[model samples]
Each structure stands twice: as structure tokens, then as C-alpha cells.
Target: MSFEIIGKTEQIELMASGKAIHDLSRLEKQYGQGKWRKLKGVALVRLRNGKIRKAELHWYEAHGIGKKEIKRKRYLD
Candidate 1:
């Protein structure tokens, strides 16, 4: 990500899971597979320029694989 997640995420919701995730195959090949899910949430982030902001984040996660490919979707404030 271009920014660092400063704290815990909030309002987390599942956008997709399992076969519903279009990138499921790539996620498995890159990170190993186990009930992979595409999730979204809002969190405080520090941008590369050292500015802090609340942003919506999206990523892929699995039981043992942890979170991968985290991206900042948009700024909340």
C-alpha cells in the first residue's frame, strides 16, 4: 500500500468469499489457499507523504495466510 495502516480496522465486511473472489486462484498460487475472502473496512492510515487519514481498505485474507494485497480504496475524511 502507499499508506501504512495506523490502527485496527473498523466496520469490516466481507465483499466476497471462496469462488466468489475472481482472484482466488492467484491468491492461492501466491499465498496458499484456505477459505480465502475479500474483505473491506475503514481504518486510519498514514500516507507516504506523512499525512494521516481515515480510508477504506480492501484486501484478501485466509486462515493461515494472513492479509495480502491491501489497497486503499478511498479516503473517508
Candidate 2:
């Protein structure tokens, strides 16, 4: 499943606990990993000065635990 963030980016908090890595591992265990691909929509990230920037979603994957592990990369536009 994909997540869409609403509201200001400042309101969003990134949890440490390796959540992102774990999630990607789980996804790879479920589905096979493949070449990096581009997503449809752009993500809005807020800077410290309250500036919003658009970024492209790039998804890549690697083999892990006999399955594919996925990693998401965001490229600023």
C-alpha cells in the first residue's frame, strides 16, 4: 500500500526505530524486488524556513532473505 501525506510537512514526524528499513524488508519478503522505478505523483517536503518543495519518488530494490528488499528514494525537483 502507498501512503499519501496531507497537511503541512512540519506536522509530520519521522520515527527512528528503523521503521522505514523494516517496512521495506517486509515488502521485499512479500514481493520480488526489481529495478528502480518512478512513481506517479510528487511528494511535498517542507523546509525549515517553511518552504515546500516537490520531489519525485524513486523506488529501488535489492535481494534480502531470499527475497527482494525495496527502498524508496525521493529526488527534489
* Global lDDT of model 2: 0.40
TM-score of each: 0.96, 0.26
> Could you give candidate 1's per-residue lDDT for residues 31-58 as a string of tens digits?
8869999999999999889999999999
True-vs-predicted CA distance for residue 70, candidate 2, Å: 9.9
Judged by whole-model lDDT over C-alpha atoms, candidate 1 comes out at 0.93
Give model 1's TM-score versus the native structure: 0.96
* Colliding residue pairs in candidate 2: none
* lDDT, residue 23, model 2: 57
Residue 67, model 1: Cα distance from true site in angstroms: 0.3
Candidate topping TM-score = 1
Candidate 2 versus truth, CA RMSD in Å, comes to 11.8
